[model samples]
Target: MSDSPHQMTPPPPEDEVSGWLRDRRGHFDQLVSSVEDYAIFMMSREGIILDWNRGAERLKGYTAPEIVGRHFSVFYSDEDRQSKFPDKELEIASAEGRFTVEGWRYRKDGTQFWASVTITAIRSESSAVEGFLKITRDLTEHRATDEMLRRSEERFRLLLESVQDYAIFMLDPEGHVMSWNNGARRIKLYEENEIVGRHFSIFYPPEAISIGMPGSLLAKALKDGRVEDEGWRVRKDGTRFWGNVVLTALHDSKGELRGFAKITRDLSDRQQVEHLRETGRRKDAFLATLAHELRNPLAPMLPGVDLLLHAPHDVATVTGIASMLKRQVDQMAHLIDDLLDMSRITAGKIALRHTVLPVREVVDTAVEASNPLIREFGHRLTLNLQDELMIEADPYRISQIISNLLSNAAKYTPPEGEIALTVSEKPGPMLEIRVTDNGIGIPKALQHSVFELFDQGASGSSGGLGIGLTLVRTLVEMHGGSIALFSAGEGQGCEFTVRLPVITTSAPAATGETPVIPSAPRSGPARILIADDGRNAADILGLFFQMEGMETAVAYDGEEAVKIAANFEPDFAFLDLGMPKLDGYEAARRIRRMYPRVILAALSGWGAEDDRRRSAEAGFDVHLLKPAKPDDLREVLRQHG
Candidate 1:
């Protein structure tokens, strides 16, 4: 009873509103629960989960019942747990109001995922510590995508560095080079350090820069997304070369202009090749025309010379005329043959009638051809050979090549000097043919161009065109052989060596039956058609045929021949392969069509294999090279006519 006074009565309730307090707290919890993209939860003072929402369940693969009572540390990966990141996060939150981090987290199944976590400390109204609340979002997919994109970009950069043949690089919008590839380095002869940051205009020639072509191209690319050009461009050394250039503008994500990608290719070599081809084609055409025009008249001259030789006259006068005719005709024939040979070689018409023949036979044939020329030059030729050395080659071409070499020796050698010709078996599958002359040697400067068409060196003589060596090279190479020219120096003598492959032997006879020289023609009148481009040639041919007791009609060009042949129905027709309106080949085709049975002979300066094939296809019965001797012409005509 004494202490009863000390018992205090229950104090009156302070001004408090219970229902509103509960309502506000419930609204805060509902706000946390409504966050669908973040794993929002509340933890107790002991780091245990106090509340879990749908966001937490969806992110961590757990329900409220499974995770609400669990310690918050369960969300940390093993490495994070060992490092005590969960406690550290709580400590930081307790001291600094909140702790936020992006790191790997774990699910209920223990698989890890990237998480963005924000932690906050909950405190009592009196400032007593309560628990931490954490919000986390799964960012694994987004982070993985970012990492993959980084790797892809690195790979693209590497790929650009490895390319060659194209100068692939980037330029800034202002036309400054920004990137360099290996191709750019090689073509510009500059390293990346030296080239990058330089203006792209530096690659253009000064003339191009004066015209603003470089800047203009950049502006075009920026406006139209791409620009292309080709012309002479300058290199680092100031040498100009042909270049093919392309520029493409780059853009950012929002389509704002970024930079340009430029590519350049060098084409100087291609330009040179096309130029040479054009030149060669023109020269071939001109020579072919000249030969046809010049040879058509010679055709009639041969027959006329034959008639004079047979006519009743003083033996001395007839002999004199005959000798003169033979000499002039021989010269003309040689010139025509040279022209035709060049044409045939260029047209790829020469056919190889390959035969296995003794190397000595070829030498002998070449020696005979060069004997007259050698005698004229007062040059001594020493012929040396190994017996029965056989080679597989076109006899005509090999003989022609050897003959050309011997003639060259005779033409260039000093009078009374010695020329040595040797045929020997070379080691391993080749027959070595060597012709060394004590003559005016080729200049060292001219050696490189010696084999080129029409390349002539200064021999102090001007009568011959410089085509023999070229023809020799062509024929030799066509036979899969090679030729080399050597000399001590100019005026010190020149030597040519030809090496040709040897075939397994069982060679042809050393000497074959001599070609049956055509007998003199019967004394009878015959009809003839003469086609030529030169008027003098046509008249000369007409006179010759008339003296031979043969009626001849002349046509100045191929077209006229076709017309005259159709009307006159001549038994013998000589059609020049090269004519003004219609070429000889075409005219031959037309005449053959009209008179299938008439003997069609092709007289051309071009006597290449391709020429022969085309003439044959066009129904020419015989292909005669220009400047043919009168007797030879008769032989060709008699066989075909």
Candidate 2:
């Protein structure tokens, strides 16, 4: 460094060079040069490098012989040079005695590196600037790490700011607010500026704070890493809300406690629901409700169990019966299980599995589930398919909807009444289904509340758990549809119209079972014809009854069965209504003429009052929904006696 008006050690003798650099043994240079991590050198006051040490050579990729006496501006980037920044450093150092900066600098290879450079002005004893001492350190790696950390922190900040639901923030070791997020601001009703650095206990109610809740929570989190609580949290406006809070301990990699992270969620709606249930609703008398709910699932199962016990050991027959019973039982279970999913529905959590399916398949499946109830009422179900169409919907929920409506109709309808299910396309892309029943209809006054929770009907005949219609309406709406009820007056007829969205989906109109018209002529007429659509259902049942002794003739379609009965003249006749050529109804009517005193049992899918009346009119002494059970065969003898 050349001496300037400023002095390096007040400038040595005027004629002699400064001893700082003019060392006889080169010891001063050796010490500076040995430090490879720093570039230590001297520069003339005019900004030209006068000497370069080993550290400078190593850091700038130039040897002393190659770089000595070169202008220091050569190491500065083009932008810095264009702005005269290198000269400015010299000027600032000349005037202020020292200048320091961290910026981009270049090496001998022209590659850029972050450099911390300091320039110190040296002056002669006469107060004239002579030279300068400069030092440079490579900080590229350190700068890179700092930049990466800065970006990560920025992203974390943005993520917290964007959240709007959960109140998330940070606390200091003593529970003072360290940071606040957008969610925290919204939920706690506190601005970031107003809340940060404040004690977290302020958010707690006076009682809670008096009890040391905030301090205790911090302690628990410090010990356990996390603590959770559901309690009242006071907001900025002094209003209180039910909140679910989680306090988690934050720690460094060294296992030292840093602070805490708090997350709060508003749960006031849930608390309000609990309060309403406590105050407005009363469900203390629950025994009858429990019985009704349990009875729903048991209706289709008990008969099957009784039959299987007394059934003969025919593998194929037993397998068929078991499989059928299992399917019916599974349907009942699935439907009843849906009724228990009200909690999920109310919580906005029930999801539907939508699929393109045939309307006939859906209708048949729902009817299968409601068969027991329909038969119990003896209602004649008439299905009218005005339009064979395909529908897009959640098959399970749709089945539940239709089954509920059918079950309700069966429960309220009178014996020997009529129930009809009609499917057609509406004006738009909607599939309309109407379930009409001529039974105990809803009174005009109670019709509006029928779909309300637990409002079954005015009559005691609408026997059920009373959640069916409510469930049906909810399920119907979930499929992007609506359900409506209509009835003229009591004892008239009730109708439910459900309109559902119909997507342009391709599917065969009828992929379900083919309806059978009564017809009988087996491979060989053995004086008996047993007809059942189920594979081996009739054969297995007939074989089982035969092993019990007595000449019990298993009949097919009512009269097709009667034709065989004419030749066989069996005293006991078991007839299925869905026979070919002649149904069990007509067969029974025909057979009763031939043998007036014969014991006849009508095998029906359901036994409604109307069904029993029709069977009796057809001359059947007894009718059973589950005709496969031993109870039915035994019931035949019991009725005869």
Candidate 3:
């Protein structure tokens, strides 16, 4: 009934105060001891350290007794302390209820340490002034690792940008160019913005696109993870080049393809080099075959003709042997000369010696040179020359060109066909020379490649190396002129016309009369030596010389000719070029070295200006082409003797 007289009375104030203090102390202990790495401490409302925990003692190198009651400003460096950062931090924390930052802080020993610090304004039940609870963790190693990783990424980006040889770029899933670098811009001629959203098929040529190569390449890359190809590619300007292209499909960790990476290289120069090398190889093989086959037939003709001319054979037999040897040897020699000339031209060694000459003289020489072949073919020829027509050109070479055209006309035309050489001077500053023939005209399709070396027309039946016209064009071009072929169609006959610019003529002297000569006359010949690789050519020339009553001997090469000079002791010597053991040039040198008095004359199939110059420098007094006329040979011998 008394209700426990002790319980009825209110609890004592002292007991209540003790219990509250105990509760607050328990909360502080739980908070400080539960910490793992952060240092936890208590400060007064004035920022003085009221308490320090084990974590604070271990991390800040401060014992409780040393840190207690000390101003929290001791955690700051001297500069920060002077700037009142610690006080400012406390004020901010109190105003905002909390403050957090990462900065450098000083330890008890004054060594600076990187720290992430959080300052909180501890509140009481009435929300009045209370101390601050600070939690801090060292952040030096983590910050260093992060900085190092950032630098490494920068280096990787720089490496990608510096590459220049390959056009490395990225594409979207649908094969759109997503990214381009400097190499891409240089190789594809597409700027970054211009190519960013364009389809990759723009790089393919029209022919490639017609065959669906672009789309097929993308599909192959998607299926196979990668695809590579080499072929012609197009640029922004519509120009084409050989390109090596590679496409690689890029994927993510989930095994789904993200996009593609494309790399391309310009291979135009490489393709050109490969093509030239292959062409050179083919040319070499063709020349070798031509040499072997052409040289075979001339072997028997040489000794046979030699024995017939020297033995006690009847005049008819000797004459017949001489004619066969001369015709066959002349044909074979022409083929060899063409091959050699083509070789020289391709090597860029053909040089021309230009001069001003009367066009009539050139035409006359061409006509006379082709007379034998014309008569053999039983073709009628007509010549029409303008009296004063003149041109600036290499006279001998121009003659050779005209003669080649005439002979070609004669060979291709039927018996009793008509061939005409007409010369006329244009009003301006050019002379026009035309050679027309009634023969099997060139087909229209062959005209495109008619001037190409070794493109023999319609193989087998028409026998020629297809070099004469090419040579004609080259020579005409060198003379600052042009040559063209005109034909109605095959079997409708063809005509070739050359137009050469003329040099202004000098004023004529006051001479009253012009000189003329009779056509029927023979120049006397003296002693001469004949040298040729084609024994048929050598024997034929020897027979011709014997008929002209000039002492002569046959030597197959330059070395033999040099030895023969000691016994024959001739006043003049004729030598052929391109012989075995030693060439005519070296033979000429050796002959001049042994017998400097002998007049060395070169009788060769090679007749280019450079060839003639080389002969002259090697001590040849004169250089003449193969299939030499008896009169020309006699004239050469007489001039030297």
lDDT of 3 at 172: 90
Worst 10 residues of 2 by lDDT: 2-11
How do the predictions measure up, each by TM-score?
0.47, 0.41, 0.48
Please give the RMSD to the true structure for each candidate, in Å.
17.1, 19.6, 13.4
Which is the winner by lDDT between candidate 2 and candidate 3?
3
Which structure among the candidates has the greatest TM-score?
A: 3
98, model 3: CA deviation in Å? Answer: 47
Better of 1 and 2 by lDDT: 1
Clashes of 2: 40
What lDDT would each prediction earn against the true structure? Answer: 0.76, 0.75, 0.76
Which regions of candidate 3 deviate over 4 angstroms?
A: 1-312, 372-382, 411-420, 437-439, 458-461, 488-492, 507-570, 573-598, 602-620, 623-632
Greater-TM-score candidate between 2 and 3: 3
By summed lDDT, the worst window of 10 consecutive residues in model 3 runs over 1-10
| lDDT by residue for model 1 (446-546), tens | 77776766555555322345678889988888878899989878888989999877554775745554453322243556678888897877777788778
- Residue pairs of candidate 1 with colliding backbone atoms: 297-537, 300-541, 304-544, 333-627, 340-605, 344-608, 349-609, 349-610, 350-609, 577-584
Clashing pairs in 3: none
